[model samples]
Target chain A: MTLRANNIEHFYGSEHILHNISLEIMPKKITAIIGESGSGKTTLLAILSSLLKPTRGTIYYDDILLSNIKNIDLFRKKNIGFVFQFHYLIDYLTLKENIALGALKESDNIEELIKTLGISNLANRYGNEVSGGERQRAAIARALVNSPSFVFADEPTGNLDTKNAIGVFELFRNFKDTSFIVATHDKKIIDYADIIIEMEDGYVKNISSQRT
Target chain B: MITPLKALRKNKFKTALIFFSMVVAISAIFLISAISNGIVGMYSTMLKTDGDIIVTQRGIADTFFSDINYTIKKRIEKISNVKEVNALILGAAPVDNLPIVGIYGVSENRFDSYKLISGIYPKSNEVIMGQKIYKMLNSPKKIVISKKEFNVSGVFKSKIGFEDGGVVMRLDDGSKIFHKSTSIFLVSLKDIESKNTITDINHLNSDIEAKTTDNFIDNYNQFKIIKTSSDVISALAFLMGVLGIVSMMSMVVNDRKVEFGIMRSVGLPSKTIIIKLVAETIIIAIFAYIFALALSYIVLEIIQNTQKFQGYINGEITFSLGALIFFTSVLMAIVGTLLPAIWASRVDPMSLILRGAY
Candidate 1:
């Protein structure tokens, strides 16, 4: 079973943002989306995450069509995770509380999860009190804590410095069994990819395979 | 649920701003309501007396303007179930330079209703004054009325605001001073037979009007005008409070749109998000109401200590009115917050996510 988008098209009030976008997200693989600004990378990520519906397309998770599901939130809770450029950690919450916020299903060993993310020492601190890199790690922990099948990240290291960016990219390398669909512009992020999807304007410009 | 509280805590300045604004708005509403209730309560208590019903000139809303003939009093006395009818000369006496003083002329039987706090009832050519009037006269031993010097007989107190500032004199003297006829006739019915007595009194003459004491007290021309205007103003104040809350809620919702977006993307259902927002609003409302009630009490106490509202309240407070004020404040909060929360929840997460590009 895999996540597939077939001939997905999207419009922002007649301005074509995504034109005939089609892709397959396979299991246990890291797929990287590389593009410049306004190239519709984030838009495609949003549509594929089912946070949005494409204007013209069909999205299938495994054998089930997304539109046929009665509860989209429950589906996303069970199957998808998201990490954004700014982390968007809730300012008032401690790191543990932030990570546990959307964990609808049980996961094995939350302590281990925070420990693995290197945020155990910072767990009691509020999101804003931590450094940028720490907040990004906390965001990743939150997305992965519920043990979703796929994690989608949009410019996950955009705000971090080179060292922190490399740290974040390397963190993705350790999760080879979990599918990652990341939209980014950082070449360092692209180096760790198993599959590279390059987009220009609203169309696929190139698709390349990486040795990993 | 916890998210909203956390958000409020995080935005300390905004939360405090909302709390303070609501406190002020709710306090205004409480003051308006309390004042109106106080006025009505004082009047109602003052009007409560030995009379079961009252008779005055038809269409004369103010007893001071009433000129019911003495014949009507005699006629009412003859009616069956009539216990006793007491006639009064209600008028005002002029001071040398001060405001005109309310004067009530009564007999020994009518004088029993007012508690004489100090000294005896007024002797011939003497007058018992209310505490307010005594203070105004600087505790004078004697005062002049209509070119005659009369001794200050005593001080008396009544629950009624107007009566608390009045001069009580013999009916003959009141007539000589004000130069008017009988103003009002108080009828005490025999053993709970007030309805039939009132009907009998009404049939005696079309020129005379008869009504229960409660109705007469509530329908006083001055009280009616003041109550109507106060009620209208209080209603307006309540409306303005609701508007203030609505404006505040709009700002809160606008500022928290991204938070809502983040929650939505994290798979929080819209219903749950709305619930959390509404819960936060209710918490704020409850706190505001409590603070407003306490503030209103303090302000009312201060107002009572001032000479302006000394006799105006007369120790009469209505809890139902307080409850009404609280209920309205809470309702305003819910209406203000719920609509905006729903709107914020419906906002597209993608739009909010896209908005952060800058």
Candidate 2:
């Protein structure tokens, strides 16, 4: 079932940050959220992921309303994954442990994922010892390891150089069966989207569909 | 659950600071507790070392100076629960021009409890000295007194505190030397329940003070031992514990602010974030506890061996089994981490993205 947010509103103290945001995220499709700075794009994504609750709206996963679920952690673990710009891997753990940490249940085949990501040689090294590209890749690997229905990336390649940014975007593109809502201002990231959503001043300004 | 050991390994300096503070806190607690235990133990041993009930002269104001009628020794034996009674005399005597020797007189048969490590119990006019006193005398072969030379019996060990600095002799010898009736009656109770018998005796002998073993020991402890050291040390330890938790948690919260923000952004609930923060503190506390225990053991061992503190300080090495300290440390860490964890969770996702903290 697809994830849907209806007329979501968010606030910061007495200040309203997001207004009347509605969106539906289908499974196995790429949906890119593009916006200028302070456009509430990240807030909308956060609300969809259920990280932040909308003050005056309803969110539903399939027909089961998310706001009614008592166990948000279980829902998030089962249905959602997240990647951030800085790739906040625990510096003490090896790459494998960092990736496996995202999964609610343990898997014996983490080495397979490491091999798939071509990070087998770097698996034993600490997160601090790895390059920026490798760290970003590890974050992607962590997000995907949970096998959630959707993956949310908030400027996932924001900290990377042009080459690493392209590589990370390619990795996101390769996960075709996992819905993607990547928030970025990177033109390269925008060009690779199947559905482009442009946001400004806490509202959706433009949306366009493209042939994958 | 994340292994705090691995986390601590990543931040060695910070971990060391936290560990140091924990050690200080635990050690202070250990030291204070040990002293309290030690004082109580010393008094208990003093009472148990002699007899069940000690009858001292009333109105004398001090047990050391109180002189009881030696005939009361026979009268106490007739009391219910009294198994045997002995008269004892305590006095100070010069040893090699040093006034450090405490003299005690007892019946020859009652010397069974006195374990002689080097010499035998005194017979007739002979005297047995304590190990420390004997050593202080440079292992004299004989001592002359009152125009007579008495052969030294073997050196003996005593569990009583004053005996460590004195000599023990038979009552006849002590009477011959001091020319006075023994001052105290040491009465052995037939069983543990005989404490009630002593209460009855106190009722009967209105002019005398009859005390049970514990009461007698407690009185002696109040008079002889210094108090307040434990309270002072415990207070200091508690303060250091609070400081340690505050500093460690503050730094940890600051370092993990972004991580907490991201967790909040990704649909992790606030309650879950709070639980995670508390769990992380508990994890850190466990590490600190283990480290503190190990360090306390090592430090205590070194103090025990180097300072020869067996008699001076009661630093018994013991593992902390009580959850109070553990719970207290975790509570402090949680309290310390709460404000920052909440602050991080409350960060606006849009602002975080704009400021590039996420």
Candidate 3:
């Protein structure tokens, strides 16, 4: 699947945050969006994830316009996943319940995903009781537990230490069948990507292929 | 919904505060209703007597203002079924700074209901006192009534509280002191034709009002007015309880803004979020009612055991009254919670996420 945004613009009140941005994201490939703080990377990511509507321009998923999708929630649930900067796990629920929340069908590989994330032992612990890195891993597991075709992550490793950050990126690389769109300032994430889009002043300054 | 319940359990103090608020409001209402009913019961007991018929001024419920003329009494005595007729002079006077002490003067012929416990039958310058009045006067041998020094000829015990702290004097002496002709006429019938005597007396004169004891009880305006006014006040209190819940539930809904946002972000639709909030509120309502009833019952038991309200509330808390109050509280909880819960469901998910609320 290919997700495309053309001339996307977003405004917060009177201030223009994103200006005439366009990008193409492909399936089974890692796309990195890198920018400084307040450069609107998060807003652009949100617009692309179908969570927010752009003030101008259009977004298409496999040539199907996102605005035309009548039930956007159902589409996002089945096709796209989101990993926020904060884990956003319900504190009352155990890690396993949080991860399995994305599993709409019984066939979804929840237990295997928990094992792959090496959080099988931490499954019964609440979000507040677990370590930060483990919660981030559980969040990742949550995004992938539904077997979504694409996952959008905003600074997934921003709170993780060097060792844990490397582990998260490596885990992202292991998803051979899932596409990723990651917004980050981490050099490690940039190096691990198949394509990099550098954003400056709310514009896409450069898009380079690194998969050769 | 389960998660909301878990959150409530974790916030134990908050749960307790909400529960206590409900308990206080419900119990306050229950106590008011019980006391009102108690007073009504005491009034009914005081009015029970052997007299079959009573005659007074038309449309007058209070005997203090209700005067049956001597002519009317004589006419009622001539009625065929009438066996005996006794007139009473009712008044209130301050005796030794005790303002509004009930004073009733009856003919010596029908003084069977009240017996002298201490001295003798009250003569012209003598008075019989209830135990409460005797205590108030410090059991004085000589007591002043209506500015005239009189000897305390006797002390009597009456079941009615009003009569218990009152004075009774001879009819001629009462007439000169209170300056009343006659307040009421009590009539006894030869047989079971008490109803016919009342109709015949009323027919003799349009200014005369006559009724059997049962009829008088049913038509008494004081009891009817008090009952109606208390019920209205009880309803208002219930409304206030509902408003209390509205304010509390609104605060709860506002405090969970972040939680609702996160649920929406997880692809849980607004309907599901609303369902969870409603379910959580309903659970709280049911639990609060159970707790309130239990607490109220315990408090009522403690009160019934105490000397403060011992004579008043002899009967247990009536079941229908308690049930009505509980039903109103449940209504208050549901109506109060539903509006705010629906509003919480419409909260913007992106704003909460962007603000880093979760």
Give me the TM-scores for chain A across all models, comma-separated.
0.96, 0.94, 0.97
Q: Which prediction has more favorable TM-score, 1 or 2?
A: 1
- Cα RMSD for candidates in order: 3.0, 5.5, 5.8
Model 2: pairs clashing at backbone N, Cα or C within 3 Å: A50-B267, A51-B267, B119-B154, B119-B155, B120-B154
lDDT per residue for candidate 1 within B1-358, as digits (tens), equals 5667777787777677778878887887778767777776765654456678888899976877888777677788888788888878877766444456677887567887879899889878999988876776688888876677788889997756667777888877776776765787888888665777888889999988989988887677787786788778877766776777677777876777666777777777788778887788777878888998889888887876566443555333378877887787778777777777888777666665666434
- TM-score of every candidate relative to the true structure: 0.90, 0.76, 0.73
Best by TM-score: 1
Candidate 2 segments whose C-alpha is farther than 4 A from its true place: A13-16, A106-116, B56-68, B78-81, B88-112, B116-129, B133-155, B159-162, B165-184, B190-200, B214-239, B259-314, B317-358
lDDT of 1 at B180: 62
CA shift of B73, model 3, Å = 8.4
Kindly provide the TM-score obtained by chain B of candidate 1 when compared with the true chain B.
0.88
Candidates' C-alpha lDDT: 0.80, 0.71, 0.77
DockQ of all models, two decimals each:
0.61, 0.28, 0.33
Candidate order (lDDT) = 1, 3, 2
Of the true interface contacts, each candidate retains a share of: 0.50, 0.31, 0.23
